[model samples]
Target chain A: MKLFQDKISSAASRVRIALALKGLDVEREAIGILGPDALNRKPEYLQLNPQGLVPALLTDEGVLLTQSLAIIEYLDERYPEPPLLPGKLEDRAFARTVALAIAADIHPLLPPRVTAHLGMIGVKAEDIAEWSRHWIRVGLTAVEELLARRQTGQYVAGDAPSMADICLFPQAINAERAGLPLDQWPRIAAVVARLREIPAFADNGPAPRS
Target chain B: MKLFQDKISSAASRVRIALALKGLDVEREAIGILGPDALNRKPEYLQLNPQGLVPALLTDEGVLLTQSLAIIEYLDERYPEPPLLPGKLEDRAFARTVALAIAADIHPLLPPRVTAHLGMIGVKAEDIAEWSRHWIRVGLTAVEELLARRQTGQYVAGDAPSMADICLFPQAINAERAGLPLDQWPRIAAVVARLREIPAFADNGPAPRS
Candidate 1:
């Protein structure tokens, strides 16, 4: 079993946190996703993950899993100890909503926004950042409302650290790094503060972009 | 089960197709996501889906499920006869690779690109369209490569339709509606052609923007 790629990938970090929670150990190979090493570009790596994305988890059964949510869900399904998803079906969906709010909505917008920042081509950095903030604000505002509905708790989904917390912590870090202020969403700020206190989260930390 | 207000919502359409596949009857309410139906504006819808996106499925148990992929997966899990995800665990992951390529990569860029075309905002329409095309082209190119590697009959995974096909068919219809060209990816084009013949896909159709 192997987790191929780097410490800096949001997707990779997600797997790491989940695996730690499950107490499962897989061989870790920190291959560079970009540049000369470009593990994602290698024929063998591409075979494992055709999309050429990072944090591709090769399961003990030798099945390579792409997409953070899918991989995480598979792990939770296979290993029930210290479950990541909530117990009830509705609660599970709610956790998924919080997770997707960041994974699908906030995560995708970051790259183009950053690419625009490089200004290597004609795309303006400010425009990209503006686009990034627009989506982040939209998603985070919704997350704030979600957290508000749940009683004052330790994580995004009630007291326990569920998939919602796992998905959100990294995105919150990324949003902070992107210079998007969280002053507007106090509930989210509270959640982030709580998540930061966890040892696993602090250990995984945010990746330093190349 | 009721599908919350959406006269013309692609997400809603996708779920409608899932229900049809299961032969389950569901009542529909057109809350009009973009209009002043107030469902999307009210706290109720916000509670259901923090993203404020359309096609929030109100289950028989009254749980509101959001995020089309997540909702669809739930449906597939519940109704296993006409499976959405097919083949072994590895093959299922491959199918998810195709699904994410459309859902996360291609779909996210569409709204901004389409709005960019309207020229109502100051942001360059051409730039937005270029960004849309760039992401779509990259996604489709990957799909094309995946197909080139293994395609048994008409469908993506094997002879039968899977979640990957379900996701791709809808997006293909959407891209065509948006006037995006498909000459570049023949394998994808072929798959789309084959999927259109399926009853489940044909009946749901693309939701028209009201």
Candidate 2:
């Protein structure tokens, strides 16, 4: 497999973590999503991924996959040894619920393109920061509350790290980066700390954007 | 099964379509997400769903499911006569990719909370409309291009209305609501027209916000 990704993309980070958890090796191609030579804007990359986003995976069968959650799900299904999703139907739903809470509700609001759009719309930088922090706080607080209500083990869903934890780690990093520390959500902070102990999650921390 | 939802919620509409497709019936409870009498803001509703989002499902097994996609997946698993996802792994991934492109990327930007935040930050109503239209255009155009590249048969993924179509219908409605017509994406418009013929998709169209 060949993966097209940017270092700082949280979505891509999720896929990278999944690959590592699956113990699979793939050729990595770094794509610039920022600056003058942004590869995601290039015609070739756009042709491969119409969304022109980072973290597209080309399977050995030559199928091109976009959308990080979809790619991670593909990986989990294709390589099912250490499944990213839980075995039980209800547990899996809970895991995905937590994942979507971050992916759909929180992370989308704070991406570079979104903040840049806010800037273009004449939103002050401070307000944009506040906007990012506000969603992060609201979303993460909900996740923390959800976790508190559940009988959580080491991870978001159960004893093992599942899709929920995969989604959580990146957004927690996003929170810290946005100046909203994980201290606000102690359960999330503890779960993230446990995730950091794993090499797959630890090694794939978001790299500095070039 | 019991579902907590609002008539105008696109997310809830996705679940409604899924349930209808599966030929299942659920008890529905109306929850206001907007205005002063918003049920989602009430202590009881928030206790039930910390995210305070619509389309939460309580299953026969007494499991509480949040997140529309997750709930749909659970329903598909627990009642598998007709799967919402495609059979093949790659095809299933593609279906989910299309779903998340809208679920995680486009729809999040147009929700009432998001637009309200923009307004609170002093964006004019016209600008907010443009903002909604801008994301709808960009995201749906990408879906159009993706469908154009594939051998789509009546739907976004295939002849069957999978998860992809479930997501597309509501978002296309959103595009129309934002004053951006579907004439811009012929393929999506065609698919949506076909989806409208199905009572599952047609009847669950975002009801007028009460």
Candidate 3:
């Protein structure tokens, strides 16, 4: 197995955390996503993943999987020792609801590509920052309420760190990067603090592109 | 079962299609999403779903499932008669990848809330329209390429209309609403045409709020 990834991508980081938790090993290749040498835009990489996004997983059978949530689900099913979701059906749905809220609602608004597009269309930098901060606050506040309403244990979904935490850890990091105080969502802060103590998540924090 | 939904929501429509495909019956409640009576923001509705989003599913067990993809997944797992995902693991992953690409990547950018944020930040109406069109085109173009490379049958993932088609159909409707020519991505256009023949997909087309 191999993973095409960029170190700075939160989406890629979600998969990295999953791989660690599952104790699965895969060859890693970093694909540049910024600047003139952005390899993700090249013909060869485009052939591999037409989305030009990082974190595409090449399975042993040579099937390529894109989308961080999809890749992580593939991993959980393929290696079920440490399940990323809870056992009960309702719990599983709750875990996924949190994951989708972050992956779909919040993170997409703050990605570099989206911000860059805003810039191209003449959105000033300060306004863009405000835009990022606004969404981070709105989305996380909802998540904070969700955790308070549904949390059964130390984590977002239950006693263990499941798919919800896998999504939350990275998004909390993103909120901090955007200059929002993590404590604004205390439940999220506590959960993220707990998650950081786990090596799988700690090791995957945003790093300088190598 | 009961569904809290707004007729015009594409996200809500995704769940509606899944419910129809699964042959399940549920009581329906239309929650206003626009105008002064926006019930989604009402205290009771927010208590049901802190995110205040439409298309929340109240299960027989009284577990309220939010997020269209998550709710559909829960339905698929609970009622396995007409499987919404494929049987094979790889095919399942592929199906989810296409679903996520639309649910997470494309749909979020075009939603009313996001566009409202852009307007609040001083993006001109024309620029906002361009923004909507640009993202719809970029995202569907990627979906088009992905389908060309991986489609094994008439549907997005297989001969059967699975989760991929469920996500695709409403998104295709959303694209058409944005005034971009659907034929710009011929593969998507074709798959959507095929999907429309299914009553599950056709019945869920965007409707005016009653």
Candidate 4:
């Protein structure tokens, strides 16, 4: 299996964490997106991911999986040794809810491309920072609320670190990068504290791009 | 089950279409979001959906499922009459990849709240339109490329209408709403045309608020 990834990307990091948790060995090719950005848009790379989004996984069967959640879930399904999603239906729903809360709400806002577009469209650089911080805070607040729910365990959704934690830990890392304080969202902070101590999350996360 | 939704929301409409396709009767409540900012921020509604996004489903089991993909997948798993995900594993990945093309990429860009934020941050109204049109075109262009691939079926991933069609149809609708011509994406237009003919897509979609 091959993963085309950006070392610091929350989406890519989410998948990296999953591969770690699942104990899947894969090759990683760093696609230089933080630079001028057309590296991902080239014909060959675009063929792998039409959207040109980073962290696409090419399975050994030759099928390409995009979207962090889809790839993570695919890995969990294929390797089923440790389930990243909860067993019960409601628990699964909550786990997905929390995962998407970060994946959709927080990460999209702070992506370099989005921020660059904001600058092009006349948003001041300082205001763009404000925008990123605001949305990150909003997303983390929601994460806090969800984490505080009765379903909460040591991780975000259940006893084991599930897909919810896989997605959230990366967003929390990005939130700190965006200068949003995690201390305000104590439950979210608590969950991240627990997740960071785990080997899978700690070993394969947000390392400088090589 | 009940769905809290906005009549014209692309994400909400995606879930509504899935519910219809699944032959599940659902009570729909129009959440007034276009008027005031953050109707989704209400304490009552936020209790059910902390992220304040619409199309949250309250199952008879009293579980709240947010995020259109999460809700749709939960319903599909529970009902299992007509599967929305393909039977083959690789085919399922493609279905989800297409869904996220719209869900994660397109819909987040055109949402009212995001545009409103742009306006507040000094992006001209016309510039916001330009921004929306630009991103919608980017997303649909990506969709067109993926649809044009060899895996092309009458629907997105295969012969049957799946979650890809559910997410894609609403996005096609929203692209038009953003004032971008859909003709440039002929393959996408053709697939959406086929899916719209189905009873579920025809029966329940972005009808004006009651």
TM-score on alpha carbons, each prediction: 0.85, 0.97, 0.96, 0.94
Give the alpha carbon lDDT tens digit for every residue of A120-185 in model 4.
877888998899898888778877876766455788888999999998887887777767778988
**Cα-based lDDT at residue B35, candidate 1:** 40
- Model 2 segments more than 4 A misplaced: A36-41, B36-42
Give a tens-digit lDDT track for model 1, residues A1-210.
788857778877888888887888778877566553464457877766676777678777765666777777777777888899777666777787778767776677665233542243354556556666666777788788767764346777778888888888887777777787677788888877887888777667558674
Which candidate do you rate higher for TM-score, 1 or 2? 2
For model 3, how does the per-residue alpha-carbon lDDT over A113-158 read when each residue is reduced to its tens digit? 8888999999999999898899889889989988888899999999
What DockQ does candidate 4 score? 0.66
Off by over 4 Å in 1: A33-50, A112-121, A150-153, A181-183, B5-8, B33-51, B77-81, B112-121, B149-154, B180-183, B208-210
B1-210 in candidate 3: lDDT tens per residue? 999998889889999999999998899988768764465457887777767788899999988888999999999989997999988899999999999989988888877788877888889999998998898888889889889888988898888999999999988887887787789888899999999899999998767433
Tell me the alpha-carbon RMSD of every candidate.
Answer: 3.6, 1.5, 1.8, 2.2
Q: List interface RMSDs for the candidates, in order.
A: 2.7, 1.0, 0.9, 1.6
Error of 2 at A90 (Å): 0.7
Give the range of the ten consecutive residues with the poorest summed lDDT in model 3 chain B: B32-41
Candidate 2 contains a number of clashing pairs equal to 0
Per-candidate Cα lDDT values, in order, are 0.70, 0.88, 0.88, 0.81
Lowest lDDT block of 10, candidate 3 chain A: A34-43
Q: Which has the higher TM-score value, candidate number 1 or candidate number 4?
A: 4
